[model samples]
Target: MLELKNINKAFGEKKVIQNLDLTIPDGTILAIVGPSGGGKTTLLRTLAGLETVDSGTFLLDGKAFDPTNTKEQEQVVGVVFQDFQLFPHLSVLENITLAPKMVLKESVQVAEEKAKKLAGQLDIESLLNQYPYQLSGGQKQRLAIARAMAMDPKVLAYDEPTSALDPALRQQVEQLILNLKAQGVTQIVVTHDLTFAETIANQLLKVEPK
Candidate 1:
């Protein structure tokens, strides 16, 4: 569903994402691993259309990313930001369904139904009535994943998803990844968790030092 070729980016004199090439087909979970500051997160940002690449071609579902032509690219990519960008004021269910209801114009009933179902599937239904502040790190991450999935994105991307969790919580998140892989959620994730990499990803890519 996504393809990138000859991607190049730099900050001042330092270069990142040099001549990078990647293709992610539908329903494939791809894990991208790299050392710190090796541009893994930058790569994710580029795919999410959050960072501009100096030179590259990025295509999502056959339509390339064009800043001047945004309609074609927007909403085709769903990103779970590294910081878990949840709305502090909204409850979990509200946060998850906001885009579907406001952006997609689904009815509140429909959106809430979908959100609650997804939350239950992700084992976070009990937390839906609560706010993000009431949840733990893993719960927050799960909430983010639920929100992303609620939008019915063509492709999903995550950054350092479980990097800050404890070992037990990390395992729980790892299992969640495997569940997504099982359910055919096409994903690109920047992760340091090698265990999740070995288990869930159909392909593993390591970003080598430039």
Candidate 2:
């Protein structure tokens, strides 16, 4: 379980989130939705440990979390950014294995094996030798998902997942997310596509900027 208590965040004098509270059970598919500039991305960033909270408490599985501790936090959550953020120069396999090999201290052979498994699961096995520039939008997104899953995080978050895809590709991404849920991977998605949100989210949270 993940719990937020009296969360508050601000930039200079402008507050983004204030006195907010939430709870997410494990194996949940949550959608964070609201108007633009309502701190939806900020919340996700905070959860991903990319941002510092001014005042708040995050509890994961009944234990308090230190968002400032990047190493420890990295093990808890993984994020897929709006732009996909694939390394332009690295091959798909390299991109997927980088973190596990470097951060997790997994051997090259082990990392490559896990990357292959995840790529196969995501249907990107054929693109392992290809660079990000060589893939289509849907393929790039699938590669991104494989990269994130390489970490084996407890929670996976997506930022504007379908922003770069057409309707058909968006449907593919939607089904991919559902499949992840069926595999017991906890997912949190931030998207403006209400129809897509309704399609996969087990819980919908509206983050309103105060």
Candidate 3:
């Protein structure tokens, strides 16, 4: 189980999350939903160690989970940011392979092969040599999803995944996410599409502004 105890986060004078507690079992799909600025993204960022929490304890399977512990965290969770934060300088393949090669220390061949598989799954294989700036919004979002999947994380978190896609593309991505459940991957998704949330999430969490 993954548990958050009395989590609190603040930026300057603005407090985002406070006294928040949540528990997620392995292989569960969770969706965090709420109004804008209600700390949905903040919570995801805190979990991904991209934001600092004022006070909180994240316990994974009864053990303390330090957000600052990057080495161990890499194996535990992968996040798809709202902005699709891709590397501007790297090609599509490089962006997908960088972490696996550097963090997991896999060989170039191994990383490239994994990237190729993900690119095919994401239907972006033809654009492997293109940079982030060259891809369209939907393509960039797909790239972000592929990049996260390349890490082979136990937990995957997506922030407003369908916001950048058209109706058809959104449906495609939604189905792709649903497929992850069978792969034994726990997902935490934040999406404005209520129907999409209903279809993909086993549990829903509403984040109210504090």
Candidate 4:
């Protein structure tokens, strides 16, 4: 389970999140949806350890942890950005293996093995040698997911996953999320698509600006 307690964040003057509390059970998909300036992405960034909260407690599976500790959060939370930020200079295999080899200090062979497995699961094994520019939009999305999954995080969070996809591709992402849940991965999605959210999310959180 993942729990956020009394979370608060703000810019210089305007508060984005205020006294927010949420709980998500293991293997559940929770979608964060709201208006444009309602701080949905801010909340997601805080969960991903990319933003610091003024006050909050993060409880993962009943154990409390520091949200500002980026290194520790990297192992526990993986994020797929809105743009599918694949490194343009790296091949698919390189993109997926880089973090594990660098941050986790895994052997090259081990990282390659893990990357290959994730690629196969995402049906991108044959494109391992291809660069990001060579991939289609849907393929790039899967590669982004594979890269995050390579870290073996307990929680996977996506920011606007379907923003650039067509209807068919959107359905693919929905199923992909469900498949991950079946494998016991907890997920949080930040999206503006209410239809998409209702289709995949086990729980929905509607945030309003403070």
Residue range with the least summed lDDT across 10 consecutive positions in model 1: 66-75
lDDT of 1 by residue, 71-143 (tens): 5325666789889999999999999988898878889999999998999999999988999999988889999
Give all candidates' CA lDDT scores. 0.84, 0.89, 0.86, 0.90
The model with the greater TM-score, 1 or 3, is 1
Sequence-dependent TM-score of model 1: 0.91
lDDT of 4: 0.90
Order by lDDT, highest first = 4, 2, 3, 1
Regions more than 4 Å wrong, model 2? 70-74
Q: TM-scores for all candidates?
A: 0.91, 0.96, 0.89, 0.96
- Model 2, 1-210: lDDT tens per residue? 878999999998889998889888888898988777889899989998899899989988999987668474257778999888888989999999998888899999999999999999999999899999999989989999899889988889999998778999999999999999889888899987788898999899876656
- Select the stronger candidate by lDDT from 2 and 4: 4
Better of 2 and 3 by lDDT: 2
Q: Flag regions of model 1 displaced more than 4 Å.
A: 67-74
Give all candidate RMSDs, comma-separated. 2.0, 1.4, 2.0, 1.3
